[model samples]
Target: MKYDFDTIIPRRGTNSYKWDTPEEENVLPMWVADMDFHTAPAIVEALQERVAHGIFGYTKVPETYYDAVVRWFGNRHHWQINPRWIIYTSGVVPALSAVIKALTDSGDKVIVQTPAYNCFFSSIRNNGCELSANNLIYRGGRYTIDFDDLEAKAADPKVKILLLCNPHNPVGRVWTPEELRHIGDICLRNGVFVVADEIHCELTYGRHDYTPFASLSERFQQNSVTCVSPSKAFNLAGLQIANIIAADDEVRRRIDRAININEVCDVNPFGVIATMAAYNEGGEWLDALRKYLWENYEYLCHFFTERLPQYHVLPLEGTYLVWIDCRASGIGSDATTLRLQEEQKLMVNSGTIYGPGGEGFIRLNIACPRKLLADGLERITHILSKN
Candidate 1:
């Protein structure tokens, strides 16, 4: 590999949300989605060059930025995006909140697939919209959407938006083109707008290819909004940069207004620089990173199968997050997380926070060096084996 992903860069004193949040010393944090590895060399170099300028003024996004985004998605994923259709924002979470605010009324409803991302719930609630969960079916250690349930939910007149997590979080399943088309057809028939949070699109593994929800059809593109970012792929979450793609003119205008109203329209200079660098020159590094991440996933699966066979690790098609079934422990997800933290000083996300169908599962992030990942897994085994 051209890039080194094996090195363990110390993040404890860096005030990292994933590491510093735990007060205990020597606590291993395998919770947050952000990677333990450093970002692509190109991105780091670009940010350093910008910092050397010392201007620190508000940034005006250049045409080159749009070109990089368009070219990257077009060449890599075959999703052609017009520069005019893109709206830059601070992050995907902010973009989602703004889209919900723009598309729905105070009393309107939004449908979300559960065991979904926790932020999806907060975003919908923050915008004064009701959450209608179309829970994913968990059968035989895999998750699948209940199309009949989704169709029923979308038919409700009050349900104005269907929030989609393409290459889904927590339970990582990259929706196939056929699956995306089915979703699009249901939304189109029910007059529901689609808001696809595809921040994890570039992190897919093996045979799973991420299909941009909007790329399915012209009508789908016109009726939906997509929020994407290099933050997840490049470990640039702190940089706070993302883009919203809305092809419809009126819809784009309303979302832009909501972005400004929400006070997330402006992005920092470093974020812009890092984004352009990542999308333009970071391809090689990203490919290596995905390979490392997939290997880490396989290592985790093997670890579970050997030492912790009682817990079932779900098939990870996309994203670095792995979902493990802890039902055999006969404890709630929150308790399982607490025990891991208190007993082994290892921190991981509780599945209960991810909403329905997450109660018996625990989401573990495996985007770290093999040594660190081994330590986390050993920690889990040390604590859970007692049960």
Candidate 2:
């Protein structure tokens, strides 16, 4: 089926975060991670079929749901996921909190690379764990992890878990194999567990291959818990379902206990159907979406290179979001975002919000119609030119 990624869909008044510019200000809401594109037709059909049954009572995920997930990882990424290792949660963020609570006691240090998913800090703190920062460095419009800092942090006895973003968010980096190996080795050596968030694993573009940290080595598997969901890949965040896959039996048991204490049983019925449909039948659509997103990335890259030289767009390897360096223009991400909002009438997220070292960079969500993308760039161009 042909996906209409070209048409601009009106998403306002649906309580969409993307369309929401301000508490009251009307600006194009492209700041959030959710795609403007609709979910795949197969997923919708499956949900409709399930809803037609007219039973919305307490439900359990059947074997087929787990099988679909396994097949998806196996076929697309060449990663084998055991059906038994999967634990369902409402969302990955919620699951992160649960895992922190499950794995560590209060005052234990949980390491997270900053300029990461903002909620990670809250999740760590909410679990009563002390948050430790391993900030990524920004150079030439792209971000890279400081392994020395990370290694030192990991080696610390107080630091318990590293919440790693495989294909990292805000600043897109599909971490290389060597990097993953080194990190995994460090974690294993230090007896630190790594909670790898591979949620954006499927959205990678070009030659970048996302290797699940747990799947790398036996030691890594023993020391890692990989979190994944169809939410980011299949545009089902609203349905709120994610899986925590722990390859180790002990870790799986602990996570299961966490789920029980948190009462995470009975995932959204619609989410189950949507997830199964996505994993089982939405491969072609995903491939096409990746191509579309890659094109959007390229279009934005070329546009900035030619028309807006001062604003350097980092080479995006994955995700629909692009990290832009507004520093060269003598404006920080805060000023850039404010100017875009109050002056140019556009909505974009300030990089500083992502965390430390995120200053002077802004993240723009390019997951929209080409026309909208073009319009946004043009508006930005005009705003910059006038300045």
Candidate 3:
């Protein structure tokens, strides 16, 4: 209520990756994970102060930045993080790549729950590791981890890591503590390391809670590298900053070396400021934003249920992205996305990009004003009504 989430901010000329990339004339981009809402007031004010100082030179991350991150997880998530366990990187994807390179050989395999964030595939492939997909089971309008497949894959001698998406993207299922423990136990038994990408950890809706992979147990903490960032929660992805928490000393050394080799250690000054501010002073705004995002998702679900019977909107427990099964609409995922863009001037992500189990689905980002969300839903309904 205190923030201006309803105002439509034009981003056409801002070089935004979400808005500027679409070649179409007036396409509404509900595709990307980033939100359309402005960041917290504290973050903006901190950036303004940093810019006003006017000295954009090589900078060292201050102690306060670490303290802010440490305090955030402790206060909000009840996870006590030792500041020594943290490694700064430009982004979570880069951190994932660095972790993969550091922990595994070229021929190693990485386990992933498919219908995941698309970048996980590239991060594994680009690091010269083969993808070992454990496709999640989609049933009863929700997604569940296929633990049997996960165990089988983890037992592979070549599989070295399990890249996790806690409070997962696309099919939004916030892993329960029991699920997290099961995953950690499977990896532990198979000598597979865990790389938990908890970027969407803070955006859970309702009673679903996010359990940091490291927060599960002492043994689990030792066997995992947890990635956290304020960029997704605060809509500051362009600033490019993330923290990699590696409690194991050897893994920490290897990751630090790989990050240096990749040249992603030189973080932008704005990112540092924004991250610290967002974590330290932006909790209220984040709470408000989460409420708005959840409401938008509820509206989307209701719209589909009441107006568009053919489409099945999945249960959205976390993140702003909604996964809708559009197969019943008599269209392929790619065709639906294309038609939405071309016919309705609306943009959404084709589910096939997230790997297997994603076909016949579409991922729509719902972190916008209610009016904009309504417009997108209407456009989708208009198209599906005739089907």
Candidate 4:
């Protein structure tokens, strides 16, 4: 417990979109994907040491950076990553855009699951690709991929890529091994390249295991690209450093070239330093953070179940975000952002913004102090009762 996650660090006036909002009254911002906790101390020390060196000039990524990344996956996930197969990117979203640009032609079709991260759609469109969404089947108190529909879309000649959000956002389903295999088979048979956006890969919980899409099979690995980072797990989104693991040499070169074209050929020098430090030393902090987030989630679930039974928190096995089905609240409490900001004095993500399947749903970021969480929920209950 060297790093305390319970303290709420002030982020206002820091150009922090997560905490910046025009609230005439007090507001609790549980919106945005960023965490309230400070990053690992090891990461801070690494970056500060870099800053102390004083010369902020161009950086040629050292072999030490790559070695740190290789060692991380090798030790924790048991996924052997070759340093050569790794391509550095400024961030995961930008990396997604680059992959879409590199692997397919303009106007080619790309598939993504809806109630998904909104960035994948824009990344696809930004690359001039026609984006297609296969909304997940919300059955049996959990989310499942629509494989029959997925294969049908992949069967189309125009379809060239499938963008996957593993440990999926909004719904929070960690696609199991069997699911990954089915998805890999569909993409492979249909001449579609798989781009797995596993940025949330390390934050999973329960018995779920994450299989890197590229690590599924030889052909799948050859035709796929995996985008991952320590941003989510380590709360280092500001670092803007992510790795694009490409098993195929040619695909690696194409993705690397596209990243170069985007003017982020080299990321923040400190970002690289912090990334290496994180993968090498932040494991214990990440593990601790997961336990805290899970507890926070349980508290939120219990609060809603007893005090606000009109609403329901979606079953989550991953991510610090808790998706709430406020359809039963009947007060349109799911305006969620509106209700949270105006009535409850809290700020949360509105589901409708995530695309079609998001309506009637709201995403609450639970990566904060328990005191803050309890206060936010208390305010919510008071508001609901008045309504």
Q: Which candidate number would show the highest TM-score if scored against the true structure?
A: 1
Error of 4 at 143 (Å): 0.5
**Which residue pairs of candidate 2 clash?**
18-29
Say which prediction, candidate 1 or candidate 4, comes out ahead on TM-score. Answer: 1
Off by over 4 Å in 4: 23-25, 331-334, 383-387
- Tell me the TM-score of each prediction against the true structure: 0.99, 0.96, 0.99, 0.95
lDDT of 2 by residue, 286-315 (tens): 999999999898899899889887677887
Q: What lDDT does the true structure give each of the candidates?
A: 0.94, 0.85, 0.92, 0.84
- In terms of TM-score, how similar is model 4 to the real structure? 0.95
Comparing 1 with 3 on lDDT, the higher-scoring candidate is 1
Candidate 3 or 1, higher TM-score: 1
True lDDT of residue 290, candidate 1: 92
Q: Find the number of clashing residue pairs for candidate 3.
A: 0
How many residue pairs collide in each prediction?
A: 0, 1, 0, 0
Q: What is model 4's C-alpha RMSD? A: 1.7
Kindly list the per-residue Cα lDDT of model 1 for residues 1-387, writing each as its tens digit: 678999999998799999899887689999988999999999889988888988898789999999999999999999999999999999999999999999998989999999999999999999999999999999888899999999999999999999999999989999999999999999999999999999999999888999999998999999999999999999999999999999999999999999999999999998999999999999999999999999998899899889999889999999999998998889789999999999899999999999998897889999999999999999999877776
